[model samples]
Target: MASMVWTRYAAIGDSFTEGIGDLHPDGTPRGWADRAAEALSTRAEGFGYANLAVRGKLLDQILDVQLPAALALKPDLVSVSGGGNDLLRPGTDVDVLAARMDEGVARLRAAGADVVLFTGVDPAGSAVIRRTRGRVALFNELLRATAVRHGAHIVDQWSMDVLRDWRCWSIDRLHMSPEGHRRVALAMLESLGVQDAGDWREPELAPLPALSRGARLLFDARWARGYLAPWIGRRLRGRSSGDLVTAKRPGLSPVGK
Candidate 1:
């Protein structure tokens, strides 16, 4: 009888994979990649994790740096998240972004990676950057086609609206909170067909607690003034925070002293 071969995984992307705001105790990448790595380590015992995610990286930047590193790993499973930065730039040519992604995917496939999972940009409605929705959708479509062409898998990160709900986002309204990252990691585990270890906790939905009318109004105003307005202004200025949103200060009232 032949023994089963396990896949060695490598993750490549930008802040999302590096876990920008979700810092580790040492302030390193604590995003979905780390969580997925931990889960896979426990599940597969010997699966390798090579996470190469830079902060504020564009698609071209990833192709230039991280792609080569991932190829060198000769990973059996490669997970990628990108394209958000390309959407941030004004007058970005979608065709160019698509071509770069296609080229990167081709290189990874040629490197003998059997399973490649590409993540889509989260929906803009749940994100601080409002202008990116259209571009994100387009990039996701391109990524899906590219993955299919390369015989890889697709992890629809954008379609997980359950995680996009306000409860899952951090104070910045951009990056995923710890809970959100956990959900995203679980989804990746499912997509990779990796079973969870004893430590893996399943995500659950709970009913929203009733709030006083004044509390609701305060929350709504804060989200609008703090998140939405700044998001719009940044986009108009042709700037992007790139998964890094300044968290709201604690112990401050809406009308601060």
Candidate 2:
């Protein structure tokens, strides 16, 4: 993408945009979106940013709730990243979800904002495994088409080999590690044609030692018990991690203040 100018930027979505995996010293999220805003602030005279993302929200919920708030700010930008949460549910349809996302993008464009969209990453090595990967692929493709139709810039995570490295993911394996989030920030800055954007292409590290089948099973069991079970229980109870949780950054203001 060519160099762009956006002084008032707003982010909207779920945990990924909410900076769940990357944390500040005070235990608050400082994800890629925040990093990107920091870089952009250097270029604009009076840049301001807002992040309206909450954890565990569906795409429709993000669009319906967060979109209005973001538009109300009259942002020069609306970074869209969501839909992974909806795909996790058993019966969600990719086409329908894409259509819903398209509507949101259209609205953002209509509001005269530069729309930046993010694709979902590969879901390998998760409990859902192969099936989830295919669903994610389909959804990513649809998101690409949606971006094209709405003239939005896209950050394609599914095809990013940099993310395939295990070190890029957090302990939960669902969110990006701190280093990973930094890499994503660099990529975003470069995507927006920000000059002197630092390198995101880190060399892959040496692989970890292989685990025995028994040890692997033990890890899997622990993961299921610690993460998977609680997530399932929340869904069963119709509860969400974001229930009553609000965006860490709710309005456009100077980056540091």
Count of clashes in candidate 2: 0
lDDT of 1 by residue, 1-257 (tens): 32223456667777677776576776554777777667666545556666767666778877897778777767777777777767866789887888888888888888887555555546655423666777877877887888889887777877776765667777866677777777777777666566433222345566567879899778768987987788789767866654453212111111111
Model 2 per-residue lDDT at 227:
81
Candidate 2 has which clashing residue pairs, if any? none
**Clashes found in each candidate (C-alpha, N, C closer than 3 A):** 0, 0
lDDT of 2: 0.86
lDDT of 2 by residue, 148-186 (tens): 898888887777777877688887777889888988888
- After TM-score superposition, what is the CA distance of residue 179 in candidate 1 from its true location, in Å? 1.2
Using TM-score as the measure, the top candidate is: 2
Off by over 4 Å in 1: 1-7, 119-128, 196-202, 207-257
TM-score of each: 0.75, 0.95
Question: After aligning candidate 2 to the native by TM-score, how far in Å is the CA of 80 from where it should be?
Answer: 0.5
Displacement of the residue 167 alpha carbon in candidate 1, Å: 2.3
